[model samples]
Target: METGKRVPVKAALKSHCWIDANDYQSLYQQSLQDSVGFWRSQAQRIDWLREPQKIRDTRFHPDDVHIRWFYDGELNASSNCIDRHLAGNGDAVA
Candidate 1:
């Protein structure tokens, strides 16, 4: 409920969560060490209309700043987020 507060992941997530607490730290370090390779693997987990040719185009300079990730990839975000869930969740609203 409070901004900037860290939530206890074990209490918030099911026991079956893909990444456990230790995994979080390891993954964070991996991302820092090899951002492109790390993100490339993560991107494959999603459905893409067309896979990305370029992974990122980020600029952090004060005057010119922008971040673009998977900009070349194409997919309907709505289908992935909402419509795709209906088949499994529609009849199991409990």
Candidate 2:
């Protein structure tokens, strides 16, 4: 059986960590309460070719259902996923 448990964050990695428990809850609430603002804030984390002027374009209805996010923005998957984070330490062991 697998035991579900949480581990304490060590000080050294805390600075590089993205969000702590409390911040995660706040982010989740922001996503629900203020979706567009949340998305706009998150979009800043990645490198964009053309920054998005509009946050979202979505319609949820039985007759017409459509959803488009960051339609105007452009980003490379490899850059966003791997290259951006490797800026300073390219030769370091993983």
Candidate 3:
């Protein structure tokens, strides 16, 4: 008799095509060390209508709660998701 249930591995679940298995440790370490810099680099991959001047902003109080990312950035969601891809993958099915 065999049980079909299986536990997922963390590495397998977090895999990325852009990152190599061997480089994962180093990249993880770098991210931990410089999260802001890492995220700034990652943000460059996206198309921003207006680039952010600040990475994050946070203010917490009993009356007011504010948390923001890319505070100065502006972007069109539809353009980023569909319009950008139309040129390369328009005919190809999603």
Candidate 4:
């Protein structure tokens, strides 16, 4: 039997990362204006792609519940994270 109770993993992870309210707002504002540029920079840092194209457009509204993602180039998140490694020595752990 467990001796002590613990918080759920999701909640624990969320609490581990803390962002300032002001910083989040600032970043969100910038993203609204130039989301493509912002994500392009992130892609470069992670070396996710050899050449990343600029984002076509992005729009965010406080009242709207949906977010729009648009780009001229194509990339699959699962492929990037897994498929790329399959050619060499990539395998999932048991």
**Model 1 stretches astray by more than 4 angstroms:** 1-16
Off by more than 4 A, model 3: 1-16, 59-65
**Index of the highest-lDDT prediction:** 2
Query: Considering summed lDDT, which 10 consecutive residues are worst modelled in model 2?
Result: 1-10
lDDT of 1 at 39: 94
lDDT of 2 by residue, 1-94 (tens): 3578767789998989888889999999999999999999999988998999788999999999999999988889898888977878787897
Give the better candidate number (2 or 3) by lDDT. 2
Residue pairs with clashing backbones, model 3: none
Could you tell me the C-alpha RMSD of candidate 1 in Å?
Answer: 3.3
Candidate 2: the clashing residue pairs are none
TM-score of each candidate structure, all chains considered together: 0.73, 0.71, 0.68, 0.38
Error of 2 at 49 (Å): 0.5
Question: Ranking under TM-score, best-scoring first?
Answer: 1, 2, 3, 4
Model 1, position 11: C-alpha lDDT score:
61
Candidate 3 local lDDT, 1-94, one digit each (tens)? 3598765557766674566656888878878999778778878988999987788777799798998888788988898888998988989988
Clash pairs detected, candidate 1: none
Candidate 4 regions off by >4 Å?
Answer: 1-15, 57-94
Off by over 4 Å in 2: 1-17
